[model samples]
Target: MENKTTILSLFLIFLFTLPFSAQESYFPPEGEWETKEATAYQLDFAEAIEFAQDNEYSESRDLRQAILKGFQSEPYHKILGPTKKRGGPAGIIIKNGYIVAEWGDTERVDMTFSVTKSFLSTTALLALQQNLITDVNDKAGNYLWDDTFEGPHNSKITWKHLLEQNSDWSGELWGSYDWADRPPSDKNIDEWRERELHEPGTYFKYNDVRVNVLAYSLLNVFRKPLPKVLKEEIMDPIGASTKWRWYGYKDSWTTIDGLKMQSVSGGGHSGGGMFINTRDMARFGLLFMNNGKWEGNQLISEELIKEAVQPSKANTNYGYMWWLNADGPRQWENIDENIFYAAGFGGNFIIVDQKNNLVIVTRWLQPSKIEEFMQILYKNI
Candidate 1:
């Protein structure tokens, strides 16, 4: 009787001491996700949900109008790809890969804008892992001898520079000139056109044309459509649905290996990026939250993910396409500095909090209110 009691006590202790993730970690299967009550985790996130609902993004649901209005200051800014009428405020909060809370139409597919950059950056990481390209620090021109990376300044650009958006790459891509994108308000068209170029890796500039150049460069490296590369390598293995689509400009086509393929965009700023649903976005967040592992498969190297989140010298709050919550203008006060997220136009965000084992996907929440909303959610967590 004493021996039985001793064994039972040891078993109880072992069960209690197990790490939360080891005991509760889950990976949602295709077309199905499980949910658990927030109360089970001793969390009350109703206030956060209410805040998100109340602070829906004020932009027009007709994203076409919003896109044009938002970039009216830029010369020759035009939509070149597809745009969807965005849905109302939608979000999902996942703890240990199980949905604890959700609101609005989480299934509705919508434009994700620059969040696509996170995915684009992933492709480059994969290329590195597969030894397709030797090193990110290598001159990008070496991979493809085409004129895209020909000039003195352009040739100096490296994959790492482009990943961090500090390339300052010059010239035109798919009819969009690098200088024309996000030009300064104080400068006229010619002045912006003739502006002095910053050395690659010295300055950080958020330009879609430059981003497209990265996409185009990746296309030449992969010798296939990026969508295919993403689907086969990352998405399908993670059990993502078939609904999501990556888009490029209508004329962003190029021949590779004797087959014509579109070089996708890194964002939807000019109307070409990723269109995906909130649930799938959560799956992606979960994958990252798990450090790029999906069910024991290391889809991407853990070292690469760690490298991806490290803040770049040019932007303390920016990593390889991922936004960090470091000490910068974008930092959220009182929040974990390690927190990183994928943000896009129209208030789309996929926030990954590794310390808390939390993945939050919120769409169409007021951009300005995200910090407060995060605070509220963290308060509950």
Candidate 2:
């Protein structure tokens, strides 16, 4: 009995000692560094391709490797956030421009949050440029709602007001509440005039409800749901996925369905919850990089692109729902200084630097401040 027990113990020890090599990470031993230890790194696209193809990075081997190649030269530097500030998962790089070189989890896709505003602003710009919609100076009240931004059409809001984040509406700001708020729970077109609490364009206050107000204005002018307009005008031209979708209320573009599905209203945002994949976002960035034109066709006129992208009010750098990059130093004081960007809550950023011929797309975790991450990105890139 003692000898039998000894044999059994020996067998158990052997089983415990066996290595389950599968659990170990297998990057080309050279590129593998501690998550926080990145100092300097450069990618050889050709080498990346070879490595991806040879080892198969994700569960997808050959084909997936091909699609993932676009990120090889992407440059995303890592910066630690200050405590509980900026927390996010980001994909960064410089392509056809300066890039963010971090390859976050490849299959990850998160809500774009406020980045949706950039899309909204761009859509309005394109519509106005094509004459599909009127100019920014047009009074939104005259076309869309029955009321002025301050109520009654006496002094209406203009496209400029909406873009500048100064629609001057009496609507309440986002206050931990999206369900029942000004711009009201039960929406009505006729009641719009009475909705004003302030005169239009008096001041700049960041209230996303004003965004919804602007949205209804689009619906009125186009006489169609905002999503369909975006699909035909912007998304299609940019070659974004047919699978892309929006979520919103009945008459808004923010509302949408799912893959193998569809819906029209632009409803969800009062602020964010947009879900888009890396490929689709890359296409969106490409569209902006190409300057509102794709292939040989002019989808969105160049004029609106110029106006919408620049800072709105002279003192403040915010431009028509987009943030101007002018708050910081110029990438080159002498080269050219007109570069700018679109920033979304969390870490989503579409940075356009015309001076350097660079467009950087970074999607990071939001709500949590990511100071460390941004510092790393700006300094390194």
Name the TM-score of candidate 2: 0.60
Looking at candidate 2, what is the lDDT of residue 11?
Answer: 89
- Lowest-scoring 10 consecutive residues by lDDT in candidate 2? 77-86
Best by lDDT: 1
Clashes of each: 0, 48
Candidate 2, residue 264: how far the Cα is off, in Å: 7.9
Evaluate all candidate structures by whole-model CA lDDT and list the values in order: 0.93, 0.50
Per-residue CA lDDT of model 1 for 1-381, tens digit only, reads 999999999999999898788777799988899999999989988999999999999989999999999999888899999888988999999998999999999999999999999999999999999998899899999999589999778889999999999999989999999999999888899998989999888899998898889999999999999999999999999899999999999999999889999999999888979999999999999999999999989999999999999989999999999999999989999899999999998789999999888999999998889999999988855
Under the 3 Å rule for N, CA and C atoms, how many clashes does model 1 have?
A: 0
Task: Give the TM-scores of the predictions, in the order they appear.
Answer: 0.96, 0.60
Residue by residue across 323-365, what tens digits does model 2's lDDT show?
6655542232322346566665445666665443345565553
RMSD of each: 2.1, 21.0
